[model samples]
Target chain A: MTTKDISRPVCILGLGLIGGSLLRDLHAAGHTVFGYNRSRSGARSAVTEGFDVSAELIPTLERAAEEDALIVLAVPMTAVEELLDDINTHAPTCGFTDVVSVKTAVYDAVKARGMQDRYVGSHPMAGTTESGWGASMTGLFKRAVWVITFDHLMDAEKVSAHWTGIWKDVCQMAAAVGSEVVPARVGPHDAAAARVSHLPHLLAETAAIVGDNGGALSLSLAASSFRDVTRVAGTEPGLVRAMCEGNADALLTALDEALAILQETRDHLATTPPSVEQLADNGYRSRLRYEARTGHGRSQESVSPMLTSSRPVLRMHPGQPNWDKQLIHAETLGARIEVF
Target chain B: MTTKDISRPVCILGLGLIGGSLLRDLHAAGHTVFGYNRSRSGARSAVTEGFDVSAELIPTLERAAEEDALIVLAVPMTAVEELLDDINTHAPTCGFTDVVSVKTAVYDAVKARGMQDRYVGSHPMAGTTESGWGASMTGLFKRAVWVITFDHLMDAEKVSAHWTGIWKDVCQMAAAVGSEVVPARVGPHDAAAARVSHLPHLLAETAAIVGDNGGALSLSLAASSFRDVTRVAGTEPGLVRAMCEGNADALLTALDEALAILQETRDHLATTPPSVEQLADNGYRSRLRYEARTGHGRSQESVSPMLTSSRPVLRMHPGQPNWDKQLIHAETLGARIEVF
Candidate 1:
């Protein structure tokens, strides 16, 4: 049931940035990808782009079931429920994964439908300020880190037992699209996303609002630092809200931590003259460490860090012993995995 | 005494990124710029690059005094005091200004030295993450906003009346180096720097630290949003500390405001699930407004906002009535000024 051939036929149930880009990259990698966009215009655009796309959800799901395709939900978080409902009715046996920014909500939703055993989660950390199908491209995921997560809410043994075929297909698709897969658990993935991704979105907006309040003269003097720090604030608001709100606990924890750090700096600055050597030094060293690990200078383009060759990638075997333990350990170490 | 020409011989102290770049740009713009660096290696490198630079501070200042050349302090904030001590002894009559990040610190230092009237502050809002003489370039200030501020702690009438000759020279130099001039008061300028520049640095470093603390797995999944937000955190630690600490009170105020904003969002997220529509929407609109004013799409390259053609430019004349009031008004409006 498990194969290295990612041409297992990908059923993408949305044609926005993530989904559209996935479809294009998979197509370029010589896969059979069926792009399903809810909007007729998006489907038409995909068709014009010589992509295999369907505007009808039922027909796409039916075809996916027939092919035993890996159904990928790439829609907005709010719209995930309805799409899941439709897929459950028509393609329940296909096995599904999602490219949502957060994993906990999606995992909970899947578990609610008693479909946790058939679901995998992906969070591809690549994008620009631009979004939508118009911003989609073949090289969007080139050398990006695609974090593979699992829903362990069900009996861990049962879920790990059922995880092979679909997980292997997902890994193959990710590798085919030029991404390195990093295994992560659902809770930790959400928390980390809240810290590194969702929290940053909130901070970007908050900082932007602060700069805006700095008034005309202050703004006139703003430069690259302000421009860069506030860059993500310009992203589509609805998208920002979806990811931030979906991971509430983790995001709140991140916000509180950031607030505490900033407050400490503020207190230090209350001195007649201030010395923020501690804050600045620690930050500088952290940046250096990040660069050292990622192997990129990070001057302009930001790509995800790849797993070093020394670490092991999990290759699943039928009825493998201690499968759940291996999954947890790999995820905690941020190591890659090959489910096949 | 007042002329439209910026061809006045210039003596630049401390040939680091700011001073070194200024020297190159002024030379390219056909002005005689004498560079002075305390470090012999940097001075030798400048000489090798065919720039006129001095390894001896006293001799450089002596020459500047003889020529009545404008002495520009391009050193770090910590180094400014000693350099001022040397200048007071060697080039007291030269009438100087600086390219420092914080105006109030330099202004206070100048006022304490009884040289406030001779000092016109120039903070050109530009630079990359890189620093030092090697990183210096000619077009660093191209189309950047050079903020012109005064040390008004002295009698306002006296400062305004004594400002024209040295102030005009500073403006001419800024314009020669391809910059627009925006006038501002020292206090407000420092406060604004706290919000727009200093605060962003703190935020960048804090966010970078947060990401690093998110553990290896979290960092593996970080993408462009995290990169851009934390870019300034990679700046030279000394430089970061200097700016953040030099504007201590203002930075504290800014941090408090940002903390308040973030806390509100955190409280809202405490609900069953979060609805961050308010935070995201306000931020999005603020970013749009900023873009509209700056006339830069801000996708990557970030330029300072420019004054529109409709705003009046303040021009100072000898014995001009209400010069201080005019300067304050122009600064508040964020308008440009032409000095002769």
Candidate 2:
């Protein structure tokens, strides 16, 4: 199938912040989009806001199957296993993707449900402290990294033409919403997420706990740096819990590595004229390296959106050898692909 | 002692970011102020910018002594010891305050130099990641917390009237520069700084080390939370070292507490369905509590520079019994004193 199926209607399985915002974005990008929310009140509110949303998942999945629409799982991590069963039963072989924080768990759930063939996983790296229907804004993903993962699959040669078409559809939606797709593999994505996302939440929680233990006086004196370090602590607890648990192995490793560094620093701090100079210097350089890698692309949002034009594009085809490896490498080098 | 003394001439040493910015704010607030920079290039640049800056330390201290101007030690922590001797010799009786990051360290050094009678200590809770003369701005201290520490003194009654007058002048500068004076005791101030400031730096630096160890692909996947958590790691290492080493005892305690939390979380993460819900929930609540404590005052910066008008004022005479204790309590309760 030489597919140009970005025009296909999309069905979203949850109408939380990510799902609700995605529905708005897909609609604005001229795609036929509808969503389902488990909360009846949330579904009703979205419907009242003039979006096509339903409280019932079965009918929504059936409609997606009928129209060959790509199903998007925008639900919580705890909801993914049960939702996969619903998808396998109702939507059958219809291709789908998710906006979940962790990738390997979703990959495992899809394999267990025998829906792996139709699954192209994604983790949209965009959000605010607020959550739910009211917090969802149309342009939330603008200039954000929409990470696309197909690395969990055994081989690119196993990805059928039909599945490739589905993956293309997902990339189209990502681009339409003004995000650059960074390709990552299943295991590595979660591992990376553990280091950069989940571990930070744990650290922030620990920081908050420590800050609070000092009572009101300590909290009162906390300045900008303390505020920044603990800012993620302000995020919804359910979200953090789901994200951390879903990627426990990688997160545990991350916690260990971070703890080792802290313990070393703590030991040195006990000596006369405390020695954290190396760590501090290395940390400063680490931040600079990250800044160099990401550049000012986030700050350089364009008024009009397009399908992967501005950034250097890496053209690739379906069934290429080590395609996942190539894509991840290309991503690290600041390259994007329109679709696989 | 009524502090019509806000008009008193001010002399500052070390034209680094904090000192340079303080000079601008003080001048703009209608105080007679001049600064000295050891780096001739820096002094020449400040002079070119129409600020009265000198390259010679002796002459500057002599002028401050002759005019009985309040001296501000805005030098790096390592340089602090050497400069104390200069202050003791050239401006023997001139009252002074410091903008050092740690209070107890400065308090100890001042006492050893026999300059305790003429010294007040402050940690201006305001900064940018950037340092140096060029990065300093006129309103950098606007709406910032000017933490005043007098608790290092053995007793409130022991504070001579002249020193009280000097403390008042410091508060006047804080208020004039649009900062809220939060009084803290010497020991408690360093302890609080450890929990909120120094400990967070260690955490952030550790985070940076962990993130970097993940290599380029992992760095590529990092997002906002990672950015926020490691933002403090971007600060100058020397500054961080001085602040941390100056308060190593408190910092070590904080580090131990944080590591315990991480280790506990890590141990649980190895179980069936990882249990981080308690930590997650507590962290979220802790953040909300801090927001409640700080309010939105930092964002609610007054267009017109203030001298203690917007917030409630707590009046107290210097040498009152437990005056430092009262000030810390008042600060926790959101009240600011005009002066000591």
Candidate 3:
């Protein structure tokens, strides 16, 4: 590919955990990266940590304007609208993406800025309890889902190619670090995350509240099990609150469903009193089924778009296993298998 | 202590995880340990793993009866009643203790045998998810709580002396291995454990149910947050089911309270949303308070019962710092530190 055809110098606005980590990963992968942060200290820290950081939004946007493609807005949802306004004024020529968890608001904001063709809503599902430049690691997005929103206004081929290239690089890194990177449509992705991610934080917070009221000594005795259940509760409260506020309806629905399930299980135990063996058996069978269907057992390279897509220009390397055969086998069998 | 005063060839009935680990720890502490398991293979494995294992329970009990003063029932709660009955008939003179999680039923059984004077109901708050003799480790009780239940029928001095000696040694070993051992009464201990331990398992089970219902692909996107929250859900479902069934009332109560609090938070978010900073501050404050109260922040040696209690003969080694200084200071400031 010509230099003009390649994606390079990917601009990332905001040098927080997600942004900083992405900048680090892309930079290490031989792409030039420029990071913008509202805080000068965050920018300084990102620079020290090997990112090309800029404090002023306009200057950073100017640098990004020179590049033909791929500017990622990695700031919080609350900041996205303001950031988009700035991006419209300064970096109007560049194709853009964002890592915002909540999409509808940011999507509307981007559309309002008349940048719908250039901007694709994205959310890379990866992070730790920690935040900021200090906690940023190069391998953060190694095996994480990088959801890209597709709409009617976008150039399908260019957008797909841009996302596919980034996805391929990220998938390789994820495999290297013993993780998985999957793709999904924006709505399903948000709903699923709200259920598994946002709702758990609420549950953890509830447990913490119980512990606080019951007595701290009782909370202290919380072993790995309690710690695991409520770990997300221990996250920065402000971020968690923001997440819940941003995705309130979906999160509330998930929480209600979860509470209902728990209540039903509790009621069942109270009345029917099923055998422990039966409950355990059900759990094992369910987990087994989940593992079977998810392609969790398959290697990352086997599912990459580069390996599975019908496009003829990207030829499979010599000695590379025929992933299509394994994919077909998996699809036929409706489960995972050894692909040798 | 004199050789006559020291218990020799202590009989540990049921060579499962607890029994096997105790055998290893007690043996390492220069105390003779004899083990018996219903499974011959388990006994053989224990012997192969360098434990003093015996295949026949009666012979092991008879041999221990001739030399030892103490017998520890390390079987499951279901097995404890039968073992206690057998011990009452076969080896009536031995001072007994148990390592069962629940205490009320076990206490009643011991009392029914008219052996309450000779029995100290104890539960070591430590273990792994793994079971069997092969899963045993030496430092299992290190820095782990060893709750001893006391009643009016028992001699306070003898019970205190016996437990003090055993727990001090175990506590010291726990500290050496970077573990903490706290002591508590049965009622409060079980209540607290239900909240911290049992409730989490139930919560995990509920999370797993959600995972199972959602498409498997959605479940695979289950990041570290989901995995952390649901890790204990993978525990032997039968065992967890039994635990929930056995401790149903307490667990249900805890679950109700937890759910109610979560519902309230959900409502708060849905109606009048709080600032993100306030939520984060609350979480941070709660965690800090929890750490401070639990002695989780204190050095292991400082928090040991050997240092906290006033029994001179039961004091920890001279080099160990006085951890009770905080307790003493709190007391001086009119804080009531209740000891049961």
Candidate 4:
């Protein structure tokens, strides 16, 4: 059965950055949220901050199940399997979900516990250089992309309907706090995260390590580009290790692809200057498309050329007399041709 | 002898983004500025914008030399040799400088032309995604690093004094708009640029290319991190190629170093989820150092622990009674220990 009321009880397990942010937002949205943290001081701190929290896990899960609550396991990846095992024994019938960066391994573990019917895996693609509850806030997920995925337990229609009900409530909650929800399956989600999130984190770490090895002179000369690319490298070691280990296979695949590209660029530079037109075009188009999607760019233009197109060359033909005005007129008409 | 007046004429022999921006800043600083562009349209546009600009090169150089002006060759890397030859043949006595990303090649060419006594090679470590005069504006180099180098042909003190007077004017102009000027020799400057600038550009290109090859799904998931890292990849292809080709030797060295780091990280990930503490610590420390240098972080504190030090263990001791207050008090004293 689906939830009849939107203000039902919501339980959060592990009050780290993501969990803390969720609890604050859910509580502010008028839902009763019970926060569970393994640390006694953390639970007490949550209570002092006016959040209903408990240090014990089993009792919290039992109480939350009694209220038919949505239980979100927001712990580190290494702790996910143990928590899943605990949930199977304590509250097997509760609605289950998690906010983990890697989804396949978690989903597989959940399915191994025979709980695929009621579980969804999600990741909120938003964070900062800082971590932990002290750095979290209610608006942490605002305008961010929250990806949701699930195992194929039932028939297509039934599963769609089942998830639609839960996902609708999730979308409503996310929207009320300003975030967008996207749906995907386990494999595609993991693969996409490899290319986008995991690989970029590796790049950050690599950049930081490289600069550190270059000594003080290199550090002094390093500016905006290096800083921007390496910003994520500053995250906590334990946290970064957990994230990387969780998505090891996918991250490796993405890293291989990135290395291949880097090697080709280097070879091209070593021999002769590489033709960077395609790379530049791809980057330009990707940025434009992203900005438009996020509402950060101007209104989209109609009939824009494809990024892969190698047409409509722009050059000066001084020999073609009286074509200057026509060239200006063509540019006004969005022909995108530039003439001298 | 050093110029008697600070308002002596300054001539810029290119109307690209850097040259145009320099002209705007120097003119605003009350210097008698002369602008020249190879393209007639570029010169005309500068004139229309209420600046003294000419399309004719030799005549402009002759006029500026007569006034003992400091001439800046702000053209492309490919054009530097021809421009230096022209300066040697037509205006040998004027003080000279060029704003190129790579310094050694330009310095060599200047020395080859028997102009080592007068020419200084400089690079402003600042730019935007856009190019050309239309994108140029005052304060483009604000809060940026401007590196100046020379061939060291004359005696130390006389050369130093000569450069000091000219460099003072350059620094004053840059500081008037908020940029710091650094002096370095050619080789070290090139090597530093490889690690800090050229390598990052290659990374951006590599990232863009990898994303483009990942099909539409990967493109969809490539968001903020991807965008930040690949921002420099969208630059004009010709310009990027020139920068990369010009710094080929140094870039190869930097790329090899980066590849070693990447391979090490990959091998570690492959075996038993390698301990990433060192990598993470380096990243964290590098980011903090960068932020501190850029004035983006909080004011300095005394006696911060080194990132490499494995000390002050943070753990919960169940046997210790009355330790809670100690832990809290330690935290208040800026200790980074986290206790369960």
lDDT of 3 by residue, B1-340 (tens): 1123243346789877878888787777666667789999988888887777888978877776776447888887778778887887777777777877776667778767777766766666677666788788887766454554444212342333444444333333333333343444455556776787777776666666666655544564566677677667666665676566666666667778877766666567667553334444555566545545544432443466444211111222311344234333322221212221
Q: Is candidate 2 or candidate 4 better by TM-score?
A: 2
Using DockQ as the yardstick, the better of models 1 and 2 is 1
Q: Model 2, range A1-340, lDDT digits (tens) per residue? A: 1124484788999988999999988877667888899999999999998898999989999999998888999989889899888888898878899999988888888877667678899988888777998789999988677888765344534677777777777887897888877787778788888988889889998888898888766776778888899999989898898899888989889998888788888878888767888788988888777665555232332342342223456777645776666676675664566664
Residues B1-340, candidate 2: write the lDDT tens digits: 2135484688999988999999888877667889999999999999999999999999999998998988999998788998999988999989989899888888889878778878889988888777899888998887677888775355534678788778778888888788878787777778888888888888888887788778766677777888899888888898898888888888888888988888888878888978898889989998877766666333333343353323446787766777667676675654567653
Q: Chain A TM-score of model 1 versus the true structure?
A: 0.90
Query: For each candidate, what TM-score against the reference?
Result: 0.92, 0.92, 0.80, 0.80
The residue-by-residue lDDT of candidate 1 on A1-340, one tens digit each, is: 2234764688999988999999898877767888788888889999998999989989999999999889999998899998889889999788889999888889889879978777888888787767778778878887777888755523564544346667767777887887778878778898888878888888889888888898887777778898899989999998898888888888888888888888888777887667799889988887766665455565423453553433345665423776667777777776667655
- Candidate 3 docks with a DockQ of 0.35
lDDT of 1 at B244: 83
What TM-score between 0 and 1 does chain B of candidate 4 receive? 0.81
Docking class of 2: medium
Model 3 misplacement above 4 A: A1-6, A151-179, A269-340, B1-8, B152-179, B272-284, B292-340
lDDT at residue A201 of model 4 (Cα atoms): 73
TM-score of chain A of 3: 0.75
lDDT score at residue B202, model 2, on the 0-100 scale: 84
Q: Specify the highest-DockQ model's number.
A: 1
Off by over 4 Å in 1: A1-4, A152-154, A158-162, A298-326, A337-340, B1-4, B151-163, B298-325, B338-340
- Position A33, candidate 1: lDDT: 83
